[model samples]
Target: MRILFSGTPAYGHLLPLLPLERAARKAGHTTAFLTHASLGDLVAPAPVLPAGASLEETLDEFHRTTGTNAAEDMSPATAGEFFGGIRVDLGADAALAAAHDFGPDLVVAETADFLGPLAAAHLGVPWASHGVGIALEAPLAEAMWATAAARATARGLALARPFASVDPWPDCLQRDDWKPSRDRITVRPEAHESESGSGSGAGWEAPAFPGREHLPRVLVTLGTIVDDPEALTEIVTSLAGREVNVVVALPPSSADGALPVAGAGVHVTGFVPMRLLLQGMDAVVCSGGAGTVLSVLGAGLPLVIWPLGLDKPLNAERTAALGAAEVVGGAGEAGEAVVRVLEEPSYRAAARKAAADIGAMPRAEDVLPLLTARLG
Candidate 1:
């Protein structure tokens, strides 16, 4: 079976499917990763998202108009609709073109693509949604789903996808949980098999790091943007020249902007293959960006989060309250908190254990078979 996976950025979005790809390939299925060209490095040989892109521009427009960050609003209705615009549809043509070239049996994406649902309908193929439900994205129409019994009996029947905000958020975010879906895969194996949950490091085998093994490494990154760099930088500076080896990822947009450091151990890089680098690192001090947090959590690398904007803070709160991480006020306390985490073996142990759990959870690749069967 051949499957085409579409996502925005390859790092966070594509990763959930990595273990899946490995599984699918091992099972003799062919799979390909499709994403925008600019964001392709994370997934090599990625198909470009057509030229004259507008998502970034539209977001800039949204930011200028709203003066509030996207992550600030947890609700999709209030996420303000920038996500549901035509600007991101710039990639549809390329995605469709790639689909035609690859002639895959299924289309899998995180939530939905920038291109609205029309493209999927146009392709005459089945599409599957995956990812941690973000603020209950544009609600699902009740008329969209097919009866489970009817759909089960008739394999080709289309299921009604639920609205993202069908219910509310979890306890802290909401008063109740969502009306569960029959096909939904929310319990990520990556998050579950961790030492924190039951499946600690089930399928994961840690890769070895030779030279930098001794130092207690702390990966410093606010992900793509520092939402509030002024505040986020404080958290980073706090870790400077301390007990941890601070590897700060300088924003490519920063042109190496000066990040004041006090200690000699603070090393800043334009970029670091953190997923690979984390193999040797002890913990991560991040801005709680969705990508960074999920990646760190999936790796079972416990965290020290200084949420700057958007979903960072919320993700930080949820993961921390659950014992997977620590949420700090700002860069002001980031340094001290990191030291405490490192000096105390419990933090490291918890993170390592969490890593074990994430390893055991069902991964995105696991859905390809079902996706394939539906598309076929």
Candidate 2:
């Protein structure tokens, strides 16, 4: 079977879909990834069909067209305008053209990417929604769908609903009042590592703070999109000052002496895979991006989450409710949160329980048959 995987052009959106994509390829199905060309490197060995504008481009276009700063205003309407309206408007044609060429039996779209479902609808093929994180609020989901439906209607096609949802979020992390919208197929989440072992920091090794071996080690990363050197420096400085060893994961752009807090107790490095970077870390400090939150919890590490924007606030709230993380308002509060998480045993215990629940979910390869069954 030929399967096409699509996602937004960002790590948090794309990486969650990789486990299932890799599973399909391992099962001998022909698979291609559809996203911006800039992310081709992250999904090497699998064919990449470039579609859509980059995140930066789409945001710029949304800002130009709507005269609203997409970054600052993350309301349902504005987010829908950015992700479902402008993104589909700019990339749907390319995505449709590519889908025609690939002729996939199935299209697997990450939750936020509407283009994949649009192409599947045009082609009359079944598509599955692969969730990246916790389920979205009803208003946001409805807004995105309403905007995407407009585009589908304009193209003289009806947007088809997904047959199933491939959810990586474990039962332990789910909200008490929330439920799934469709048939849910639980898949264990794994930290994304490139097939060729050539990712950004593949060969990098964690440094040993020889004298500080007894000190609790914490990782500070803002994920791909939220690159604030000042915030990162403040968090790192705060943690380091508290007799905690800090490791700051710097994006490639900021690797050149951008972070000013690196000192004897603070280590700075480039974008390493979360699987590799989590080694020997006692805890994490992050912006609560889905990828980072899931990876850290999967490793049984507690977190100090200072959400910046987008879905981060929700992710932080959910994880904090699960008792695996602490949500702070700003950088100033992050240090105290991390220290508390380290000193308190409950946080680690909750994280470990979450890890066990996540581990009990079906592996991606095991879910291939379930997805393929929908083809019939």
Candidate 3:
């Protein structure tokens, strides 16, 4: 099978796909990834859209659809950026020019890959929603979009547009059990039983960080796009000189010099091989972005979340309530929150259960089989 895949820059969005991507390769199917240029360099090289296109185009469209450019639009923009960006990103994700530019038997992506579904629908080919984040129930996601419409209409801006018409989740996966809907992952064989990709393979080294072997490690990330260094700063200070070891992967800042200043007790890096990082860490204190949360869960570690910016708060709500982790409001008390979560055994217990929940998911590598059967 030939696959054209589009994913976002957020580590949460991209990394969960690695194991699955490798799995497909092991199965001997050709796969190509569409993402940021820098990241494309890190992974197997694939076409990259303009690096800033995601935020730029998304913001432009949000303003256009809502008819708000100045301050009137700022509030909703802060809260609903991801929810609204999908419409603007649709064309690219679906590979409009990209679709014909690179024809594939299938297009695989998360719901955020706005254009993937449309392009697949347009091509009369199969497009599977390879979610790395939470499962967006087709109906519930629609309702959330509709809620955005109400906000737009209240301001007398533009009218609400139809974003999704079908159920986003496949019929078989939908369940009302109220657990964190982690990635319905499928790892390709190259990634499943193999550590080659995690080390040096194909001229790329698997993501890993040094000097963290002996500490009771904690991973704190705010993802690449929606960064909050102030929160990291606060976290380090809170744990200042504590016995526990804390390591943060600050992307976008991409600079070890940009590491969060802790009280000589915390260590930070611009990037860490996340899969390897998660395997070694005891827990994560994050903004609850999807890829990181899913990875941690996939590894069965507890989570202490301080959701900031975009879908994080919403994502936090699901996992925290389900005993997978704990949630702090934001950067304000990030450090204290981390301390509290760690002090309590309940957090660890819940995290264990959450990990088991993730193990139950179908591996992300099996996309072809699932799609073939579903659309057969």
Best by lDDT: 2
Which scores better on lDDT, 2 or 3? 2
**Ranking of all candidate structures by their lDDT, best first:** 2, 3, 1
> On lDDT, who's better, 1 or 3?
3
Q: Which is the better candidate, 1 or 2, if ranked by TM-score?
A: 2
**CA lDDT, every prediction?**
0.53, 0.87, 0.55
State the lDDT at 83 in candidate 2. Answer: 82
Candidate 2, overall lDDT?
0.87
Cα-based TM-score, every candidate? 0.71, 0.96, 0.71
lDDT of 1 by residue, 1-376 (tens): 7756665443445545445555566678777766655554444333343322433564566567766454355354333244433323344456556667777655555543433132344456556665532443224221112122132223332333422211111222211353555555433433211112211223443332345446787877776544344654676667656656666665535654556553456655554444554666678888776656656766766789877765566678766765667788867888888877777767666666655555554444454454454433
- TM-score quality measure for candidate 2: 0.96
Q: How good is model 3 by TM-score?
A: 0.71
Model 3 misplaced stretches (Cα beyond 4 Å):
8-11, 35-39, 42-52, 60-94, 137-140, 143-215, 254-256, 260-264, 330-332
Off by over 4 Å in 1: 9-11, 18-34, 49-55, 61-75, 78-80, 88-102, 112-116, 132-180, 186-215, 227-233, 252-254, 257-263, 344-346, 363-367, 370-376
| lDDT for each residue of candidate 3 in 288-332, tens digit (9 for 90 to 100) | 766666666667677888776556776777777667677876565
Candidate order (TM-score): 2, 1, 3
